[model samples]
Target: MLASLITFFLIGLVALVVLGVVLAIVGAVFSAVLGLAGFVLFKVVPVVLLGYVIVRFLAPKEKRLAQMERKLLETD
Candidate 1:
């Protein structure tokens, strides 16, 4: 019974060590991915803002066209 208990403790210790190592590696990978995602989000935000500005600039002309089309449809 004593030898069996010793064996069980040793096996559990080894398993815990291996699990710790695997978790450390996974943590590093997730940290890097989070950093990359942050960079991409920063980059995309400005482009999106610029796109909105351009659309806003063109909106007046689009509104004029839409109104003309609607008027013609009503006549038909």
Candidate 2:
């Protein structure tokens, strides 16, 4: 009976250790993923959005200028 109780205790201890290691690995991976997501959100996304806004704001003016240039050329 004592031997069986000792064996059960060892098994339980090993199971707990394995569970702790698995949780640690999972937590590390989750932290890395969260950090990368934050970098994209805070850094990359805003730069891309600013570029998009600049392009959108300039495109119509460029088109209008091209049209005026064409008209001037035709008049010449």
- Tens digit of per-residue lDDT, candidate 1, span 2-62: 9999999999999999999999999999999999999888998889989999987777987
Q: Name the lDDT value of residue 65 in candidate 1.
A: 88
* Candidate 2 local lDDT, 1-76, one digit each (tens): 9999999999999999999999999999999999999999999999999999998778888797898899999999
TM-score of 1: 0.56
Tell me, by TM-score, which candidate is best.
Answer: 2
TM-score of each: 0.56, 0.76
For model 1, the superposed segments whose C-alpha errors exceed 4 Å read 59-64, 67-76
lDDT of each: 0.93, 0.96
Query: In model 2, which runs have C-alpha deviations exceeding 4 angstroms?
Result: 60-76
Clashing pairs in 1: none
Q: Which ten residues in a row have the lowest lDDT in candidate 2?
A: 55-64
